[model samples]
Target: MAVLRVSPAPVPAGRRQDRLSTARPPAKLQISAGAHAADPLLSLPDLPTPLKEKILCMEMMGIDSGRALSLNPALRSTPLDSLHVIISFLLTKGIHHKDLARIFGMCPAALTAEPRRDLAPVFNFLAAELAVPSAAFRRVINKCPRLLVCSVPDQLIPALVFLKRLGFKDMEGLAYHDPVLLASSVEKTLLPKLEFLEREVGEGKEMVVRCPALFTFSVENNLRPKLGYLVEEMGRDVAEVREFPQYFAFSLEKRIKPRHRAMEERGLRLSLPTMLKTTDHEFGLLLQTADSSPTVGP
Candidate 1:
């Protein structure tokens, strides 16, 4: 049987190889030598590999990447290592990782803060100047994370000094509990509130130092309206308010006005503490049991 020598498959092997080589394979993605592979779905902004790493890193830390990035443009160029430094530095200062999420969320500047110049001196001032114990560092910082980004000489030291001058005896308590005072401006915030109270009550300095929370209140929205209700509406003297300065601490609309109205309706006049301090149920009980003859006593 004659073996039909089948013709060499379509073309010569060399020609087939030539055709395969000449015909271009589908176009490829040209990634740089050290660049990361692009995300498959979205063509993201052209960001440096390290910067993208920083964003991912911060997002993992529970910071709002969009807000933080927008508020702090420095983050664009901030080295990934710089973020790590800030994170590590805060952790060293007794700040928990969870706490860092809240802290940096509030003040993104802290995410890029210099470890020594910006941060170290804060603890130094807390320890040496303010005499805040090392252990209380976390409590103080967690109380006010803005402390980390503040200038030691410009903000913290001056605020502490001002408070001390005003006879704030419980420095530790102020640092931990009412830290927003330290962040407050002596001229813009603390002093103005004090002056307003002095004008109204004639004992502003003593009252505020006695109850530092007065500084946190809005003079326009809080102090003025509450004092107005106390003097003009309640027919009480400023001296009476001086005795219970925390009267400003309670919500005028929610607690003070309603309770005071409830008292007037029942003809039961209670002291500020007696009226304001009691719960709704207690205040109701007070209205029921107290002499309906309006027993007004400081």
Candidate 2:
């Protein structure tokens, strides 16, 4: 039972008024060696009966518990600066920079760059105060969407790849919603066509495209049933005025919902869904899903 002694001096004139009344005088105590054997031993100043009792109650506990016991306004006689260390030390156990970033609506890469001498001590105190990893006791944090905000246009490709690595697979649709990043690249004419394709076809667990543009080319056996087709006899019809590509294709295995399935599956056996859809709307949503759900937990 090693004992610790705490001696608190009077708070300076300018600072003491902010956290506590300055009416209280400074304290000095000559504690017994027997009392010092306790984990937390306090030397007290001239104080009222109630205040003295509170300080005694805190000193009875060990150092870690003593700080907690002293949290009460009546028992906390430590100066404001000392209290700052105690608070920071105790708080460090519960929070880390990542958590702070989430709370502040910013990315971990965006923490303030200011230098600080006191910050190091506070950080060290916190580390010592909370040796346990906070992640062990808490659920994993959700990835923030704000990180995807990009000012540089070229970052779209790498950003998408990075997001995929981080388990955000269904992000193609978000490109339309976001003001930055890939969303900006989607032209007004092309965006809605993508969205209509998604809504009409039902995105990619099952996909099919059919058109008469490639009459003689041998269709892959695996993809034939998924094809959408228009009759060749209607070549001169207004619907066929739009030029068809050398081959009509469908992206068959996507993860988004509500659209982007095969034309055959959706009965959209049209000559030019792209041209027709594109003329009607400027921008559309393209949603792609991942093969598996995200992993989340502590």
Candidate 3:
């Protein structure tokens, strides 16, 4: 009976059409969490089998995997031929394979660096200007690889010139003991330390040459405190400290103070080495014997 009025309710204006049109196909959800992540090692081009083996060998020789991997990019950019040349040149210079591996492990950049542009000048300066004997070259470079990268005019030459001014004519000794001095800052490190020794202790280049190890010690921590203790506290002469500069190398808290205090209490005046170099057991024995000994009346 109501068929005449059973027509579907009039469609709302644009409702059905809007619903139909607005309904979009499910979007392809793209998660890029790990999909696009880069591999650190993959960024480097594949290395030759031999090269890969060599790197593995280096890792076995105490170079960490991360460091060895980090070197890959530089190695990739550097031609295999260039690496061979560098290795060959170093070998010709008397650097053994084991030493070469150690050096390269320590300074991977040297493996990729330009031989003539980056390394040759340093070698030349050491051999010719500094008179570092060819026989000792490998040993010195092994000790301080930074010498290969340091600037001749800026860093190395100035240090050499200053050392020469300080009567350091024995380049072989300097290269062996303090090649790091060639890589240190002339204005900042070398100058201030030299000035401190000179001004405070009447020590100069001669003292430094005698004990190149002095350059390796810190002025604020090792040199100043030890010198002050010996001079002001102990009333030791400046010349005495200069004569036994190795005293500065001993630990102030552990070795110097304890030994000095023991010696002072016992009225003993032993050489610096003897005073500080003894083992704990030996030192304790000395202290015990000193305590038990008769006190001589002055």
**Evaluated with lDDT, which candidate comes out highest?**
1
Q: Model 3, range 216-283, lDDT digits (tens) per residue?
A: 78888889888888878777787877777777888888888888887788876666666777798987
Query: What value does the lDDT take at residue 148 in candidate 2?
Result: 25
Candidate 1 off by > 4 Å: 1-43, 46-49, 290-298
Task: Summarize candidate 2's per-residue lDDT along 44-117 as a digit string, tens digits.
Answer: 44554444443443333212324343333332444334433433442344544344324223321112111133
What's the TM-score of each model vs. the native?
0.82, 0.15, 0.68
For residue 211, model 2's alpha carbon misses the true position, in angstroms, by: 22
For 1-298, candidate 1 gives per-residue lDDT tens digits of 0111112334556677776778733333332333343332123467766666676667657788889999999888988888888888878888888897899888898888899889999899888876788878988888888888878788877888888888888877887788888888888998899889888899887898878889999999999999999988899988988999999999988899998898887677778988899888887777767555356433
Best by TM-score: 1
lDDT against the true structure, per candidate, is 0.79, 0.32, 0.72
Candidate 2 positional error at 297, Å: 43
TM-score-based ranking: 1, 3, 2
